[model samples]
Target: MDDNLIFAVIGAGNTGQAMAGYLKLKGFAVRLYDRSEWRFKSLRKHSMRLSDEIVSSQKIDLLTTNLNEAVHGANFIIVSTSTTAHIEIAKRLSEILTNDQTILLHPGRTGGALIFKKILRENRPDLKITIGEFESSIFTTRVSATGSTVHYYGIKNGVHFSTLPAVDVRKIFQILKIYFLKLRPIRMCSTLL
Candidate 1:
């Protein structure tokens, strides 16, 4: 587990903020991005107040806008945005990302990874894409609305991830285990839908 792995978390909403805080605590360089202006503001305010506790001590870097800038050199990209924006975001990211990049879809619902794969294929057929999934995103985490801070109640119950063709599962899991030590790999079945 490399402590220097850079992580870009899209969608600075509740889930995004919670995960960012936790990842920072684990010593990963994390940057956050969101399309919503409100979310961006919230993240900034929270970061400012928790600067000593979350930023200064942990050295977590927070970025609200500029998707390309946040993700350009990141080793891992975590998509925590709503389902409606999933396709568009995936399409935009596919254009800029290289084949070696790893993408994790938090709270990957039915067909989420498949949809991303389809869009990537339509745009960059030659590029190999590998999208992973989790049992749930956030791990029962919550952020306080009053103080605009985060609270991680418990570790993730389980994180289930699978890559296309299944050959890249080990590599993906190895990277994930750094941040999520309790992650459990799910057996692949014919239906990813």
Candidate 2:
């Protein structure tokens, strides 16, 4: 990943923490966001410890409950929330997203990218962005009780994913693959959905 590439993980659950921690450890500037600030209270001094598959302790660049603040200037945004929350998040993002920003839903479930793009287009027709989703989460991880530690059971290999328009898959995958090496692009995303 380029040092200039900024990443934001929007969800403070297990996968979100692991991804944020892992990215921070890898030297990418990472901003972590959640709807609730209470979720971040357990993180010791804003630092997270990642163990198991990968081991590292690093301080995330930013932690905020403000969605706009979390994604401000972020080149890539990772929506790690539940599939059920996709529509709401998409509505919220329609208000905040800027042109050319890329969004990737971690394990978009089935038609996730399409649903998200539809919401974006419906809400903000002028917005120019790429939406994509993983068929499944890339991380098989869990967070410790204190919230200060993340146990990464494994990083999935050859994870399949696709973008809403399909054509942007290769371009987006090029940057994403630097962080998640096993990412594979599928030609037809709806077929999997």
RMSD in angstroms, all models?
3.2, 1.9
Reference-based lDDT, each prediction = 0.72, 0.86
- The C-alpha stretches of model 2 lying farther than 4 A from their native spots are 44-46, 189-193
Superposition-based RMSD of candidate 1 using all C-alpha atoms, in angstroms = 3.2
Taking all chains together, the TM-score of candidate 1 against the true structure is: 0.85
Question: Residue-wise lDDT of candidate 2 within 57-160, one digit each (tens)?
Answer: 88888889999999989998999999888889989999999999999898786677888878988889998898888988889999988787899999899999
Residue 179 in candidate 1, Cα distance off native in Å? 2.8
TM-score of each: 0.85, 0.94
User: Which residues of candidate 1, in runs, are more than 4 Å off?
Assistant: 45-59, 190-193
Q: After superposition, how far is residue 169 of candidate 1 from its true place, in Å?
A: 1.4
Query: Which one wins on lDDT?
Result: 2
